[model samples]
Target: MRKWGPLFAVSLAAFMLLIDITIVIVALPDMASDLGSSYTDLQWVMDAYALALAAVLLGAGALADRVGRKRVFIQGTVLFTAASALCAFAPNTATLVAARALQGLGGAAMFATTLALLGLAYEGRDRGIAFGVWGAVSGAAAAVGPVLGGVLTEHIGWEAIFFINLPIGLLAIAMAARLISESYGDREARIDVPGMVAFTAGAGLLTYGLIRAGGHGWGDGLAVGVLVGAAVALAAFVVVERRTAKPMLDLGLFRRASFVGIMAGGLFTQFAAFSGFPQVSVWLQSVLGYGPVKSGLVLLPMAATAFVVAGAGGPVMARIPPRYPIGGGIVCVGVGALLLTMVDAGSDWPVLVPGLVVIGVGIGLSMPPMSAAAYASVPPEKSGVAGGALNTFRQLGFALGIAVVGVVFRAAVENSIDGTPAAGRDAH
Candidate 1:
């Protein structure tokens, strides 16, 4: 137990943060009913956390490298625990969304430091064991998150999902303080505050604009203005990255074709596979009238398949050229998305099984190699930055994917339900 104490601490933090990514899907409807949330509020509820995570992830990494990984991790754990309490007690959708964003900031701090802390804590065979176990825990988080959330929401209420994190966060903090030692990377590494701010502004504005366009039309003056601001902010982000002395992401890496491909693969894998999940949960509960547990169970095949494939096939896939596995795997994801198009007003839950399984297979195949490929593309000194960049892109993809899918889904639903009996029903 002593030998693996660091693993326990880091894995606990990883599980808590990663599970939050999907745990809320099954509880969205319950939250809506309780909070009187609008459709846009529901979208923000999901996107706000993801957006904050994506935006802060790389900067957090840089900050950790300078300030000490263990110290930052503990601070993050404390903040995450406090934010979870805020989320549990939030009185409205706006407050909940704000709390969720705070949770994401804490999550970023923990996530950015976990691997580094593990690297510092272990060596040789023990390090390998620690990493393998941590990887399994990370994979399992997604698989179990919804089921756990469903059970908690059904039995204990939606707030239980957030409240559940409290004990886990506190335990992680205590374990980390007792067992984990401080470590640092480039002590001079600077947080790219301007770049983070610009990128976050751009992404947030873009999502807001899309949500606005869904209800108010693309030509709505406010939507158009926000979209234009998004463009300006994104452009400013690019400029800041190019000019900053120690950027969270080194923009020069994009000059490499392989690096670009790997980044794109990382981003779209999440977008193609998991982005529409919140909307799916909404359909299951509101349209199909499934309870939270049943709705969570409905999505289990994909995550289960993903876990099995990644564990079983990872070693074999590592032997081959990464491009084949990553490329073919993402293609599978796109095909699975196509398969999901079969879901209609009259379809049952099983319609999702085949698509989910395929996407799972894709995720299993692609994700294991993504980190290695990204690291290989850069020099040794830049490997950490590369890792941070890949994760940032992936989270950004999830955030943006949710916004885009929500807009399209709303439009399609409106078109299909026009003058129909379902049109009069509560879709929110």
Candidate 2:
């Protein structure tokens, strides 16, 4: 128990944070109804968490290195657990969004240190076993999130989804403190404050702009201004990265075409795979009148199949060239997403199954190799940064995907009802 206790703790953190990502999908409608949330507020409920995680992840990695991995991990777990409590008790959408963002910040800290802690705790074949178990836990989190959320939301209430994290988190913190030894990287490493700020601001502003534009249209002055601000902040991020001594993200990485491709693949893999689910959940509950449990069940095939494939085929995928699996897998995801577009107003949940399965297969095929490929793309010294950057892009992709899809979905709905009686009808 002592030997594997660190893996258990790290896996607990991964499960909590990753599960939180999709758990809310099944509970969104209930939350909106209780909190009087608008569609934009609903989007923020998801976006705020993802944006914060994406923005802070790299910085969190650096901070963990400078401080101690176990220390930061514990701090993050405490914050995340506290924030989960706040989320459960939030009185309104605004407060809930704030709490969720806090959760994201904490999640970033824990997430950025999980692998490092595991690396420090295990050796050789034991390390491989730890990683395998961790990977399984990560996938299980996704597979179980919606279903668990559904059961809790339906039987207990939406608050239970967030509330459930508290005990799990506390257990993790206890195990981590006692079992996980502290580890550090280069003591002289700088935190790259300027770059962190610029990247966070840029990502946050861009997400806000997208959500605003989705609600108010591109001509809205505030939306346009926010978008411009995002552009400026992102440009500043590039400049700061170039000038900073020991930058958070090394700009030289982009020079390698393989690295660039791997990063792009990571981004789109997440976007195409998971981002549309929130809206899909809303449709299941609000439009189709399906109960939360049924909705979660409908979504289970994709995650479950992905879990199975990744576990069973991991060895075969390891032997293949990274491109064949990653590229072909991404293509599968694209085709799967395309299949989903075939749905009409009369379509049932089954319409989603084929696409979901294909996407699952794609995810399973692509995910295992992505990290290994990312590490291989850069020099051994730079592999950590490369891994961090890939995760950043993946999270950013999810955040942006939700916003972008919301805008397009809203436009399509409005267009469909442009001259119909429904065009001017209000829900009240």
Candidate 3:
């Protein structure tokens, strides 16, 4: 229990931040209505948080390693809590978007150090259990976020969602400060400012292009330029890291198959979840006409399956090679996603349940072990960098997933419209 305190504390903060990711998604409509927003405003609200997180995560991780994880975590808690308050009180769309970016900055600091803290706090088997527990908390947060947001938005208004983070963040900060021991990364590591700059800018460009292109149209000159610029910047980042004496991110981590596989798993996990859930919510509300409460309740099986499997799977993970849980998880996701294609426009709960549960279970199985694998692949001194890398891949996966699905869905819609008369197509 003593060893678990920091892990739980960090997990609490992570859960709060991740929940904020999907939570705001559910409140998009309410926020748009209240702010008298155009489509662009809503996109900015969502994109701001993600982009900011991606922009700073590697830097935040490197900073945490140098400065001390506990110190970074405590500071992040304060910043995130304050940002949440700002978001809650924002008078309009612009203010809310700005506040969310601030929240992401805080979140990045907190997230970057979590696994590092866990790795230091526990050893071997205990570390495995800690990852499992952390993964369970993350799974639960992601699973419940949309429903919680819906309930809050339906009853308490959109501001309530952001306001809800205040207490959680404060509690996490207090607990983390008290329980987590201080730790630093490599003792002799120097700040690699150029590498950090290139990596951040490169990742930021790629992520923003993937996200913005979904809505702005793929052919948009800015999006194309952003994508091209991302490629160039990332190439430069590689060059800088290879030549620099002290690099923020070591390029060698990718050499290990375990590390690469874990990264791939993380990406695939987010790809499946984001590709399915938010879009399905639209179908549920717009097509099936389910209320917020009902729609939320309907997702309970998916959430619960993840929670249960993750908690139980820890011991199992300790006994087996990580490949089973991680690979099996992806396979489950693939199969689940395929099953979801059977969901006709007129489909009901029975059609949705199988796909959701399977995907949830896959996420449950994969995330915990994948986390452990990534952490295990690196030296303790590099936990911060490894964590940042893992999350960056997952974030990229989320954006790519949304973009691919959006493109496919749009094509389908266009095809359907093409079948209609020219007048009807023009009306649409």
Q: TM-score for each prediction? A: 0.86, 0.89, 0.93
Judged by whole-model lDDT over C-alpha atoms, candidate 1 comes out at 0.77
Candidate 3 per-residue lDDT over residues 301-341, each given as its tens digit: 77788888888888678779989989998998788788777
Clashing pairs in 2: none
lDDT for every model? 0.77, 0.78, 0.81
**Candidate scoring better on TM-score of 1 and 2:** 2
Candidate 2 per-residue lDDT, tens place, 336-377, comes to 888877777777788999998898888777765675576556
Q: How do these models rank on lDDT, best leading?
A: 3, 2, 1
Worst 10 residues of 2 by lDDT: 419-428
Once superposed on the true structure, which residue ranges of model 1 sit more than 4 Å away at CA? 1-7, 118-136, 189-191, 206-220, 375-384, 411-428
**Candidates ranked, most accurate by TM-score first:** 3, 2, 1
Every model: Cα RMSD to truth: 3.8, 4.1, 4.3
Per-residue lDDT for 1-428 in model 1, tens only?
87899989998998899889999988876897899986667767777788677767776766776677788889988999999999999999989999999999898888777766766676554554555456556655765778889999999999999999999999999999999987666776666778878876876677567556655666789989998998999899999988888776678878888899988988898788777887787677666667788888888888787777666665566567879878888898899888988999788788999998898778777775665576567554444455567777778677557656766787664433232433323232
lDDT value, candidate 2, whole model: 0.78
